[model samples]
Target: MSHEHRHQSHPRIVARLKRAEGHLNAVVAMIEAGRPCLDVAQQLQAVESAIRSAKQTLIHDHVDHCLDARNSEAEREELKAITRYL
Candidate 1:
């Protein structure tokens, strides 16, 4: 799903996402190379963990900035939507 453009994601979150993208690419390469099932499974798990960590970072940032004051019902609902996906 698309997020708001005004919702400025932190630099660290971007970096984490970039790293996760690299991990995903590596997993694709392994699949193409005829890797064993267990090896590929481990790599997949690593990607999942990375994505989860990234999600947490974004959630923390949103809570600290956008939702800190508890104003803006729309923003709070949006943040809730983001959290449910995680």
Candidate 2:
């Protein structure tokens, strides 16, 4: 398939993002429960880390499956853009 077609095809990534959304909601609940600041901070940090890890997994999948499938240098470079979030 063409790069154009695959550029927006992110089913696996959508799943990871959905999971991250659940993680985020849990963190919010922790805050509403009057948890200690340090504990909340830790949970927030874990959520951030989970999000980053999920993003990296999605990026790697895009590079190996989508970008590489199309053999497009541009798409491959776009995959590197995930580093900006780190």
Our model 1 lands, by Cα RMSD against the true structure, at 3.0
lDDT of 2 by residue, 31-58 (tens): 8998898988887787787677767765
Candidate topping TM-score: 1
Which digits, one per residue and each the tens of the lDDT, describe model 1 over residues 44-72? 99989988988887777776666566557
**Which residue pairs overlap in candidate 1's backbone?**
none
TM of each candidate vs. truth: 0.76, 0.58
lDDT of each: 0.79, 0.68
**Candidate maximizing lDDT:** 1
lDDT score, candidate 2: 0.68
